[model samples]
Target: MFYRHDNWRVGLNFKNLFDKKYYESQGDWIRSGAPFTVLGTVSVEF
Candidate 1:
């Protein structure tokens, strides 16, 4: 979701909305993935 007004802007982002469990493998390494993450941002221009 996002919103904008004049010179100001706002936004939201979701990486993992379901809160699921997962993993990742790279070469000889194993890593766990992020769960149920939410990111938000805002900006203004002069």
Candidate 2:
């Protein structure tokens, strides 16, 4: 969560929130996961 004034900025983020299903390995080559993500951000500065 994030918020700011003056410069104008707002942000919120959430990733992998209870998606639960993982498997990642580089040794034997195994990857399966990452399926639930939500993010938002806005910024302006001049």
Candidate 3:
């Protein structure tokens, strides 16, 4: 984590580490989550 009063921060996230297959359903409709993903993020607090 970044220190307090910091001007900016950076972070990384990894999702679906195993890359499995699955489905999400609602109202006879289906959606799927990603198999594998990587993300980078930045934040600035006022």
Worst 10 residues of 3 by lDDT: 1-10
lDDT of 3 at 8: 75
What's the lDDT for all of these models? 0.93, 0.88, 0.78
Cα error of candidate 1 at position 42, Å: 1.2
Which candidate model has the greater lDDT, 1 or 3? 1
Which regions in candidate 2 have their CA more than 4 angstroms from the true location? Answer: 20-35
Mark the regions of model 1 whose C-alpha exceeds 4 Å error after superposition: 26-28
Sort by TM-score, best first: 1, 3, 2
lDDT tens digits, residues 16-38, model 2?
Answer: 78888898788989999677898
Q: Estimate each model's TM-score.
A: 0.72, 0.35, 0.63
Top lDDT model: 1
The sequence of per-residue lDDT tens digits that candidate 3 reaches over residues 1-46 is 2333468778778888899998878999999977888888788877
Indicate whether candidate 1 or candidate 3 has the larger TM-score: 1
> Which of the predicted structures, 2 or 3, would earn the higher TM-score when compared with the native?
3
Residue 44 miss distance in model 1 (angstroms): 0.5
- Across 1-46, the per-residue lDDT of candidate 1 in tens digits comes to 9999999999999987998899989999999999888899999989
- Sorted by lDDT (best first), the order is 1, 2, 3
